[model samples]
Target: MKKFGILVVVFIVCVAFLSSYANADVETEKISLNGSTSMEKMVNALKEGLEDKYPELLIEPQFTGSSAGIEAVLNGTTDIGNSSRYLKDSEKEKGLIENIVAIDAIVIVTDTQNKVNNLTTQQLIDIYTGKIRNWKEVGGEDLPIVVVGREAGSGTRSAFEEILHIEEQCQYANEVNETGPIIAKVQSIHGAIGYVSLDVIDETVKPLAIDGIQASEETIQNGQYSLQRPFVMATKDTIEKQNEEVQKLFQYIQSEDGQKIIRAVGLVPTSNKMSY
Candidate 1:
């Protein structure tokens, strides 16, 4: 009987030791993210916070168009694709799932030299669609309007057009590839007009009012600003099912801590439970 009891104790000890070892040896998750050049600041914040909290985990992020992010998810090239627009029906059909991470408002801006503080929605549409060619036509100086726009694939363009019902061709003098470029162009060029997320608004340019409403956090939260869109995280079925690291990454993003990073970058958090 004594011998049997000693063996049982030894077996329990070995099981406990092995369990501890297994937990200690658990590998850190590594995830890759792509999409939404507009998410530059937010993604950087995410990287900093995530590394601080879980140094064991690794995350790689890339800036491409939001559509490119969705495609990356579908192609299994990325764990999470950041998108500034909602996922399309075709994307759902292709086995991609979208997780809304934040809400952002599209802000229309003009060169600081223009002195134009306000524009109605129709006036902005007319200006960008080339209906109004001169800044004087929209309560500004008598300068010809230099329309600036994002590239065709930009989620900002899609969301802006959709909100404005701007079916006309983009009548821009130039098409910039990213938000930074657009902001820079608008800042440097007098009579220039462009749009970007409210987070990117700076003193170099002036944000315009739409339909008497400003693109501000309060206005966006109240739905007074009509150009709000959901920023999403995309994942394809192949990666969701087959990639353990990808799954862990999504899980962490949906967690409370992740929402804080989302808000820190000036976008509205999707999760109310997550503290700002």
Candidate 2:
């Protein structure tokens, strides 16, 4: 009987040790995200939402330009590259895959003090092309309109110029690298105007009504917002080809809960939860 009791105790100890080891295996992993300064808001939303539900994740996001992000993923330097625009055909040929995470509008903002509240599509084009150099040309104060813009190679710059159909023809008074600093520059400089992601706008600047339509989630969803583009994440391989932890991160982004976060940030989630 004593021998039997000892055997039972040993068995219970072994089971407990195995269970503890299994629990220990559930620890966290690190995830690296790169690219797209324009994707900061959306990626931050994803990071916050996913990290809460998955405490085992350490998500690090780097805000490089869209092209850099695509290159990073294709070169296997990072697990994911966030982009504010869809992948170009040239990038597609590089075996890079774009995963559309959400839809964002490119909004034209002037200083809050500027009286100009609306602009037609043609007028915005003229303003950037330097044909309309003064605020009064667009029905604002008599101050000279300072056209601020993103630097060359910026996704925001590409989307803005492309949608406006001006391409490299824009006559910018100043060029900035990121959305945040541009807002500050516009706030300090009178008659300053610039374009940024819709979600980044605040009381600091005023959005101009484009073609009598405001850029909002509903307008973006219904295709009424002409300045909208897809928010994307580029990967070297399909979602299935990523590591298990990376796949989980993408899964959380497409989950219903993840969509809620995107909506709360004033960007529209992809209709089917993922795209591109």
Q: Please give the TM-score that candidate 2 achieves against the real structure.
A: 0.88
- Quote the positional error of residue 169 for candidate 1 in Å: 1.8
Model 1, 29-75: lDDT tens per residue?
Answer: 78788999988788788788777877777878999999898888789
C-alpha positional error of residue 125 in candidate 2 after TM-score superposition, expressed in Å: 0.7
- lDDT of candidate model 1 versus the reference: 0.80
**Which of the numbered candidates is closest to the native, going by highest lDDT?**
2
lDDT of 2 by residue, 46-153 (tens): 898889988989899999888788788888788998888878899988887778878899999989899998999999999899889888887777899999999998
Could you tell me the TM-score of candidate 1?
0.83
Q: What's the CA error at residue 146 for candidate 1, in Å? A: 0.6
lDDT of 1 at 41: 80
Candidate 1 residue pairs in backbone clash: none
Model 1: CA > 4 A from native: 1-28, 237-244, 247-256, 272-276
Q: Count the backbone clashes (under 3 Å) in each candidate.
A: 0, 0
Clashes of 1: 0
